[model samples]
Target: MTFDPTPPHEPRRPPPRSALGPRQLVGAILVLLPVVLLLGGLSRCSFAPGGPEIDPSAGPAVDAPALLRDAARLAPFAVRIPAVPPGWRSNAVDRATVAGGPGTAVRAGYVTGAGRYLELVQSDAPEEALVRDVAGTVPPPTGVVDVGGTRWVVYGGDEALWVADVAGVRLLVTGSAGEDEFRTLAEATLAGETLPAGTPPPR
Candidate 1:
């Protein structure tokens, strides 16, 4: 038999895999990822709209009296602490500097018995500046509502505003409160009732 001059052909060997080096892995990923993404996109899926399920207006219940006392300690002059009617809740209190004065400004947010929301900004800032801050762009007062001896300028908008100066501080009351609820808050703030001057716990 004539010996074949060509040696037995060795089986073609695959390029050594190099134990899946970074380049091979990256190339494999580049090739397969698009297919995986296309498949995932074609699959029908549904989800609730993105946002917290909790109500935005909801906040932890706070002690109105305690908050007022704390705020009073922070404020140089007495800050009005309304005897919020039954079922009323105080949600938050903030201490700030009076815009143009040396005293402290206290802002308290309240939920009325009828579930109306409002905020009382007791700042020593100029009444004009404070009103502008509360009402954004101010129009000539649509009218004025008098609560006891204090007269509050009524401003109408998406959010209503009733502004006055009481207890030597320019007070601004505004929010989702109705006319009646707004009047109630104004009366409470201007009614001369104040938080006790109890010292705030050492902090």
Candidate 2:
């Protein structure tokens, strides 16, 4: 066989490949940005922190009975202190002036057994004026409920306000407690004995 002297053919070179196109790189970064940020945020968040724990149910300790007695001795209208169920606590007691009127209001606030807060106001002021005093705005009565032979005027929607005229005074109950708790307070107020301001003994 005659020897062929032609040089060997050079190997074919494939087209140069880019690591990533600008558009592909941008799309990949956009998709991964959110995941990176989410992971970073999760790393910073702690399930349990080394700090003092707060008790949501705990409230200020107040002597409601003594406050009521003092109010009864000074208030022009009658006062009644309800015997709330166990685990309930009174957090506030103070006198408030009737709005746009000529009367005083005695208020008592309680944190219920379920950690709900509510208030009772006793005043000689008319319903409208007293409501304006307690609530920033005076809302029209939505309905009336007969609880324990007494009529309680209901106002507002879920955040309800109840008013009743009993024992020569207008009693208003407003709070975050449920309707059942409201009824319980109303019944207790009705059942409680009327305590009128007593004359001071000779000094």
Return the top candidate by lDDT.
2
Give one digit per residue, the lDDT tens place, for model 1 in 1-203: 78866669867667778766898888999999999998897784533242112233466677766677777776666577776677677888888765533555578888776556788887767766666665666656788887888888877776777778765667888877667878887877776466544456336
Provide TM-scores for the models. 0.61, 0.69
Candidate with the greatest TM-score versus the true structure: 2
Cα miss at 22, model 1 (Å)? 32
- Candidate 2 lDDT, 12-73, residue by residue in tens: 66655475678887999999999999999999765433222223367477888777777777
lDDT of each: 0.71, 0.80
Off by over 4 Å in 1: 1-58, 98-104, 195-203
Residue-level lDDT for 70 in candidate 1: 77
**TM-score, prediction 2:** 0.69
